[model samples]
Target: MSAELRRELSRLDTLANALDSQFRIPGIGMRIGWDGILGLVPGVGDAVTLLPAAYLLYKGHRLGARRMTLMQMALNSGIDLAIGAVPLLGDLFDIGFKANKRNVALLRRDIEARIEEVA
Candidate 1:
């Protein structure tokens, strides 16, 4: 991958991870971000949070992240969004569940695994 692409993906991962961090989970809260406040507004916060994943999924598809891999990432987003739509449950789930973070991890792992295969 080119330096620019790496930087872009890194930034996206940071943002996604931040969204996942608003919770108090151990080993996860370090990435906490403003999703709590921003997400208070209806329709916008969730949309903002999901956008990065959508972009990443599109990019991943273009970059040839396998169909199943891409589906898993998409499924993560779907689950997050679905659960996040609930009243109190969504908020709690948002803080506890780090779908974006998980997706980033998945992507990174895929990258690493491919690299290993080459070696």
Candidate 2:
């Protein structure tokens, strides 16, 4: 991968990790991130969280991800947004789903495959 792509991926990875799993729950062995914290709000929170996820999807597309990979990323984000629309349970679900992380993994895999193909 090019340096720019590597940097962008690293940045997105950091952002996604922060949003999805930044903190640990000490005794319970659970973790939560900004997404979960923001999910405390009703409508606005979910909407706000969707922005970053959408941006990641856009970035994935720009990086030349395959249609299927893009679709999978969209599905992950869609599920996160859909179920995350619920009030309390959705917030809890967001804590565990980590859709952003999953999307990043998908993006990385796609990038790696492309690199291998080029090689």
Candidate 3:
């Protein structure tokens, strides 16, 4: 991959980490991040989280991710938003789901496959 692409991927990885798994709960070996914390709020919390998710999708599109790959990313975020709007269960689900990480993984896989194809 080009240096720019590498940097972009790194950025996405960092963003995903921040959104999905930035902190570990003491003595529990479980990690969570802003996504889960924000999910604690009512309707606004889920909506707020959607902004970063949308940015992920937008960056994936700019990176030339395939249509199907983009769709999958959207689906992941959609699921996250839909289910993550619930009460306590949604926060738990957000912690476990890690949708941002999943989307980043999908974007990385798509980019790597494209690079392989070109090479």
> What number of clashing residue pairs does each candidate have, in the order they appear?
0, 0, 0
Q: Write the per-residue lDDT of candidate 3 for residues 15-115, one digit (tens) a residue.
A: 99999999999999899999999999999999999999999999999999999999999999999999999899999999999999999999999999999
What lDDT does candidate 1 reach at residue 77? 88
lDDT of 2 by residue, 56-117 (tens): 99999999999999999999999998999998889889988999999999999999999999
Local distance difference test, each candidate: 0.71, 0.92, 0.97
The regions of model 2 sitting more than 4 angstroms off are none
Q: lDDT of candidate 1?
A: 0.71
Provide the global lDDT of candidate 3 against the true structure.
0.97
C-alpha lDDT (0 to 100) for residue 104 of candidate 2:
96
Error of 3 at 36 (Å): 0.5
Question: For residue 40, what is the lDDT in candidate 1?
Answer: 60
Superposed by TM-score, candidate 1 places the C-alpha of residue 35 at a distance from the truth, in angstroms, of: 4.0
RMSD of each: 3.7, 1.1, 0.5
Off by over 4 Å in 1: 1-9, 22-31, 34-36
Please give, for residues 55-104, the per-residue lDDT of candidate 1 as tens digits.
77887776656677888999988987777777676766766677777777
Instruction: Report residue 8 deviation for candidate 3 (angstroms).
Output: 0.4
Off by over 4 Å in 3: none
